[model samples]
Target: MTQRICGQVVRVEGPAFRVRGTDGTEWHGVVRGRLKKGKRTATAPVCIGDEVEVTPLSEGQAVIERVLPRRTCLVRRTPLGGRRTHGKAPPVQVLAANVDVVVIVVPAPAVRSTVIDRFLQVASSGGVQPVLCVNKMDLVPEPAARQHVAEVVTPYIRSGIPVVLTSAATRQGVDELAALLRGNLVAFIGPSGAGKTSLLNALCPGLDLRTREVDARGRGRHTTTTSAIYDIGGALVVDTPGLREVAFALDEKDAGDPLLLFEDIAGLAARSRFQDCSHVHEPGCAVKAAVACGELDEARYREYLRLRRALERSPSD
Candidate 1:
């Protein structure tokens, strides 16, 4: 029997994966049959940030024998809007495993609170910390642009979430962002045009992560096609393909509470007249009262409601 070594998967493309050991050695390997035969929670048996046991074969090649248990995992459903997978049940896609922090990157002047809320739900549900990074701020220095970005992200800030305004172009907030991600396994996730790759390059200098410009229709061209991991100043960063949308796979019993992200609303919920109040039509709803009385921003409350509806309609439900 060949000696087995413990390693962490840095990337997975098709059936092959790149695993890095503690000694800084790397191996290219294919998943062994046992992993394929066993039941898997996600579409891919191995994902970026997974720890596994590898068996060396010859040269630089090896075989992934076993997958270690994951402490945290960010999961989502397959892309159903674009290409059809032939009526097959959408397999769960694990974006990253064992992540300490999830960095949601959004381009300034074009940020969408709904999208950010969805990512926050995933991070919160997965039991990991989430940091919202607004990139390309330098490109949108106009007061109107600043206002738009501020309006979209203010609720999250008020809810105790850390929001970093960064500009990869001008190096604005780059150091601050890097400090936050240091000494942890951070997964960088965002929409296609959100400047994720560019930001990584800015932080690490020579990462050379590919980047592209948004089209005239305000849609970003896909720059990253696969998930990969990199080391940036001792931090393990997992970079994933650009996501056009994040569809939740939450179970009804495990659906994340949007109000939980809102400190004020969550605190008021405890005082609702009905323990099971949905906060929409029930009387004596403290949440509703707060919104009506301007104690809480109505727009923020509405976004919370929108997130709740999305979770309720999750495919897993």
Candidate 2:
């Protein structure tokens, strides 16, 4: 009888995978040809955090026979030639599987609301909880400047997303972030120089993940070239390569109302007089009314409209 065991994919590199078996052994495995040839929607059939059944062939070697169903997955639309696809809908690329929380790390004093909203949509659409992690808080030493950064993320906090202010240099909020991630599979995703690796090091001492400083232009240099999962104090954490842009993985059916992710906008929409109010230019539009009365954050409303417009535009358009 052949020895078959269950394992979770910890890292993927081209055609090779590192799977950690239930018996506490790490096996270098590759997917079976039949499994690779099967119909799939994602750009890759295997991703980090995927559970698979493996047949051990020899020491430290195995063949991945099947992939178990994912409880949750984080995905984004594949870019065309390094840009958003215009004509045909882009295929989805699965970033990680079985993710419980996605930590969107951003540097202080450089918070981009639009980018944060895009990441929120991706997490919400993928059935994963989103947490905003504002890293490098120590850079803003002055109280006024630090307050400004806090104000920038207040909209997200109001929308029920947990926001953690962390400074790897000062070890601030690292414990809070770790508590939030305890006992869950979390993925750290953000643009380069956001200190994802540094935070991981703080959480699990002596891990010593390589990190680089921001470039002269203030952009992060990519240090993590591939996605890999680490076992940290009973929690499984995945650190992924920095992303320059994030586009929603949506087909016609999956591209329904984007407002579902924007709780603040949705709440206002519920009060609109018209049951099908477009909110762009409609009579008794609660969303616009709130914006006019200064009850709603203008920036948040603008981002919501931008996302809605993007979704409304057809692929061919």
Candidate 3:
């Protein structure tokens, strides 16, 4: 009989994976022949939150033989990075598996609705709940900064997305965030310098994930290189390295109605003169009218257009 043990993958480093067994023991494991022989098509055969069968090879060592089924997975086509890949973008990178909620962290002082929209699309495309977490509230304590944060998150909140204002530096809203994530597996994602790690440290209290200051350019340096999962009380949190860009492979069905992704805009679009209104320069377009009347945030409308164009340019378009 094989000495097989069931475990969840906490993180992956190159070809090795850190798996924590149901017995609460962790072991470094390598993928066995089955996984390496094209069992899965993802760029990364294994990812954080993956449940797998590990066969112990020796003390404190094991080999992953089979990956159990995942309830949900967050994936994105990674942009070109580091080495040249001959002009082709990398295959779908599985950010995490079995995630219940994807907390999209955005910094207030430098929030970009485009980034938030892209992550929203990715989360919905992967069948996961998306939460907008505005981190670094400490930087926005002043009235002007507070107003900026409010303005940035207003659209998302109106769209029915859960928005949490957090400040890892001052430990503000950390308790609320913890409660929201309790009894759930959540993944924190955002651009490089959005304070994802700092927020995690604040929530867990002793993880001490490395932190770095945003440079003079107002961009955050990469402090997390690999995705790692940690058990904070009853909640499972996965912290990932900052993403510079996000892409979604939209097909005809997906691209046919980009407005559907924007809840608030979609509601207005439902009242448009045409059933198939593109919401761009279309006559009697309720969505456009909302933007003109100042009922919708112009920035969000522009982001909608940009994402719509991106979808229109998809291979299926």
lDDT score for residue 77 of model 3:
71
lDDT of 2 by residue, 42-76 (tens): 77888999999999999999999999999998998
lDDT, candidate 2, at 207: 91
Span of 10 residues, lowest total lDDT, candidate 1? 82-91
- Global lDDT scores for all candidate models: 0.85, 0.86, 0.83
Per-residue lDDT of candidate 3, residues 122-221 (tens digit): 7887778988998888877789879877877887887788899888888888888888899999999989899999998898888999999988988899
- Per-candidate TM-score against the hidden true structure: 0.92, 0.90, 0.86
Q: Give the top-scoring candidate (lDDT).
A: 2
Q: Report the lDDT tens digits of candidate 1 across residue range 197-275.
A: 9999998998898888999998889988878889897788999988888877564566555665666788889999999
Better of 1 and 2 by lDDT: 2
Candidate 1, backbone clash total: 0
